[model samples]
Target: MNAKPLKIGVIGCAGIAERRMLPALVADPDVEVTAIASRDGAKARQFTQRFGGDPVAGYDRLLERSDVDAVYVPLPPLLHAEWIERALRAGKHVLSEKPLAANGKDAAELVALAEDRNLTLLESFMFLTHSQHAYVCEQVVQGVIGELRTLTAEFAFPAKSADDMRYNPDTGGGALTDIGVYPIRTALMYLGSDIEVIGSWLHVDAARQVDVGGAALLGAPDGVTAHLTFGMEHAYRSQYALWGSSGRISVRWAYTPPPTHSAVIRIERQSHVEEVTLPPEDQFANVVRAFIARVRCGVPSGLEGESLLIQADLVDRVRARALIRPAR
Candidate 1:
């Protein structure tokens, strides 16, 4: 028996929705792009024209649509808490972009609200859904990495324009919240959520009070450690490595890869080095499917809430203790 596709509404017509998410949603048989909303009618229309959804003039209007079972919120960091609350209260499941809130306290509040409402709330850390990571976990569990000791990850790319929203502090613009969260969440994935912030460093645009880039040191009580570096001011890098007692595992493209990108995991042991190439996958589509499954099953609280709070806490810690370097 076939199930009806989950009818989805997209809030905020950001570039990511146009470039990555909408295409993935329309391609998935389990998802129906029911509506797409933007303040600019023309912008919403452009997305609907390419993606096969009805254009909505405003986010509030999209949320009111009973046809939408779930919504994907890709709005700016400052706008997340407000819109997510409204969507959940409207009885819609939410899948939001990362850094779900500006801090841990706010994130916990949102989690509690969703729990009380019995709604699914998930953060979009798309990399975790890729098959390559599952394979990495398999290797670690199989002793291929020989008792994982330390993990290091870095995810950075070129900087945005001066007037970009990423540079606006009020909009939750900063390298840490934007790019740094990737490696931080990756550490929480491998090292456990109990991970603590050892120390951090940030390059701040003093006048703007925006963190341009930074690195964080995280450690678990079990002696495992993860060093993460991320920023929008550097050349491209999307990778992480796990070092163990006997061998090491490295992924050349760990974080964000296009749907057609084949992920290569390299294992180096005392005897030899091997490269495992995974078939290309679209993690964006994978996450969308996962969201649909959760919505259909009416999964209760804690399916992904605990991790969201943990990630939010770590980001706050990094920002709190960062050794700031003024942007030049």
Candidate 2:
């Protein structure tokens, strides 16, 4: 690791990067946003200028710059694997936005390629870096909720414009890909990856060419079960609940950033009830710190082959079996 700051080039001057990653990078003292790129060069220039950086015409141009040591790929889901593979082959470390790829097979290929290239490849599941999630994990282990028996998670948000990429199946748009991944990720994280998905149901929006809502039931061989749901055609709601033999833990808005949202984990023993409140912190900042640490210290982003492969396979299986119908 060098004493000088590591240089980063951002791909996809889109909503998530513009709203979250760019601001966080500019604020971090340990890293420098040296360049930005997008299919729309003007938008890339605007973002780079706004953040006091240089603009590259496209991702390939940015990757060619020897000064850029790493790249952030926040592009649409379908584009994730291709660009990630390209970045690694270009000898640049990559911090990518989640789902790793449109499916599990692609994720495995990318991971293998990055490993061969000796470059970091991480899925940006930022919530895992947040203290709130740590607090929840600690309570679960502390038996504040007793033996974990059941878990439930729900995430929903209003649909985007009719023509947005999120509504385009070609780009891997769907409620499951958008908001559902969080709950499914949480379930896998908390219950462990050995769990089996018991049953699932998905509803598609023919109008938008993606899913509008869906749910799944999962069970672990170790006596744990989870129910998860996600939707893009509903009032905004994000929540998760974990139940145990003696009590239950709940987060009001689980997935999204809520720096000040306090949650209660209720513990009920034979004749007593206890409520534990969890304070929140800046998740985006935490993710940046974690990624930089990996860049500096050479640690993998905790996204290795096994778990991500399981997640990808689960998603693929669920999508394949889902009884999808054309929009009504």
Candidate 3:
């Protein structure tokens, strides 16, 4: 017998939800967005009209509904842990936005709660679902890039508006939490979790009381190194390159690519260069499918408790060693 469709309640109406996530969920046949909630009732209503689902006035009320079997939380980082805990206790599976919690301890706690309840709690890192990333990793393991020496990833864009939530420290705002975590997470994917922060630097916007940008150097147990750089106030750049003894591989449009955009991966060895083009893929849709599978079929997506714990711990270590500098 086929499993029932997964009923999802959206807990936040952020831009990501409207632009990418909601559309993806709506297109999937095995999933249903039963409800949507935002701090602003009107915004929730707008989202429902544009997408599908009933608009809920408050997130708590949405959680209390028996119709919702799961929740998609796209709220600010600071509120992730609290809402995740509440949703789990309410018997709903959770898929939350990244930078899982404000700190590692809280993230660990959320993971424990989910495990105890036998519920799926996944961090919404959409890029991980993209086929291009897996292709890159496979090539590295196949020795196409020879012995991996260094991996460098950068994600940055200008956010000068004061109204932007990324500039608000109270909301767990910071370049590292907002965008830097992407490179760090991707680095961990290739370099393994047994990595250490060797050096770090951060630019702080004191008036805003947030880290606007930063760079971190991580050393893997195998002597491979990964360099990560990110900022909310800088020229746009979103890419990562892997350097090996024999050659180098670079991927453009590494993160935040639209569903219609094709990705290009370049490989260079000695004097020969090769470019691999991948077809358009909706990573958000992939994530929704994976979440549904885990909830309904007990399929593992490799995004379990240990992965969240390791990611949170690495983020904490990078933040701890960051030397704060005045924002440019």
Highest-scoring model, TM-score: 3
Best candidate, lDDT-wise? 3
Off by over 4 Å in 1: 298-303
RMSD of each: 1.7, 2.0, 1.1
Q: What is the per-residue lDDT of model 2 for residues 30-127, given as tens digits with 9 covering 90 to 100?
A: 88899999878898888977986788888899989998999989988888888988899999989888878988889899888977887777788777
Candidate 3 ranges with C-alpha deviation above 4 Å: none
lDDT of each: 0.88, 0.80, 0.90
Q: How would you encode candidate 1's per-residue C-alpha lDDT over 169-270 as one tens digit per residue?
A: 988669998889889888887888887788999999888889888998889999999999998889999999999999999989988899999999999999
lDDT at position 273, candidate 2: 68
Clashing pairs in 3: none
TM-score each candidate: 0.96, 0.93, 0.97
Clashes of each: 0, 1, 0
- For model 2, give the 10-residue run with minimal summed lDDT: 258-267
Model 2 residue runs over 4 Å out of place are 259-275, 326-328
Clashing pairs in 1: none
**Residue by residue across 1-328, what tens digits does model 3's lDDT show?**
7667789999999888888888999899888889999888999999999888899999999999999999999998888888999999999999998877988899999999998999999888888889999999999999998999999999999776778788788786688887888999889899998999999999999898899999999999899999999998888999999999999999899998989989999999998999999999988988888888788777877565788788889988999998889986
